[model samples]
Target: MPHCLYLKHLDIVPGDRANPCKGLMKPITIVYSSKKGYPLVHPCTKCGHLSRNKVAMDCTQED
Candidate 1:
């Protein structure tokens, strides 16, 4: 079974907490790869933001 990562409550308010609105709204989830058997390669806060996993320079050069 593939594990799923849940992301929620990602709202940033420029001002005070009172009357704050949800900004940049998004519900994010990550799934593990079946063949590679690797976890999501990135830094994700409990808030649900997924970091961009850039291909390594050396690996790309091989192709």
Candidate 2:
């Protein structure tokens, strides 16, 4: 998933791309939660915006 579609940026906020920081988000780590299951933590390569998204059912830890 694209971070611009999910991450909360500076003033632009989440689920929006109105901001000028069109940075590519890279997955940094994965965390397991009892409620949310496994979510991957991603941070923008340009502006450093961070976001966590639930991994797809078919996705593996190596991804």
Candidate 3:
């Protein structure tokens, strides 16, 4: 499963062209999952755009 926490700038594509600040997925520490086990609400901290797709896992964690 993709973790919709923090992602790199090169990993994801821009969701909206109207957003002036284009960057990585800056998770706002908020996460919401749907009943079907899918991420429904994942907002970006840079542009505040809500991403409702599969996201990559956080890179800051050590496996």
Best-matching candidate per lDDT: 2
| Ten residues in sequence with the least summed lDDT for candidate 3 | 3-12
TM, every model: 0.19, 0.60, 0.34
Q: Compute the lDDT of residue 54 as modeled in candidate 2.
A: 74
| Candidate 3: residue 34 lDDT (0-100) | 66
Candidate topping TM-score: 2
Quality of model 1 by C-alpha lDDT: 0.34
lDDT of 1 by residue, 1-63 (tens): 442232222334423444232233232433456554433343344333443232223232221
- Better by TM-score, candidate 2 or 1: 2
In terms of lDDT, the poorest run of 10 residues in model 2 is 2-11
Instruction: Give the Cα-based TM-score of candidate 2 against the true structure.
Output: 0.60
Superposed Cα RMSD, model 3: 6.8
lDDT of 2 by residue, 1-63 (tens): 422323434346655667787767677788999999989898888888778877667543421
Report the candidate with higher lDDT, 2 versus 3. 2
| Candidate structures ordered by TM-score, highest first | 2, 3, 1
- Between candidates 2 and 3, the one scoring higher on TM-score is 2
* Superposition-based RMSD of candidate 1 using all C-alpha atoms, in angstroms: 13.0
TM-score result, candidate 1: 0.19
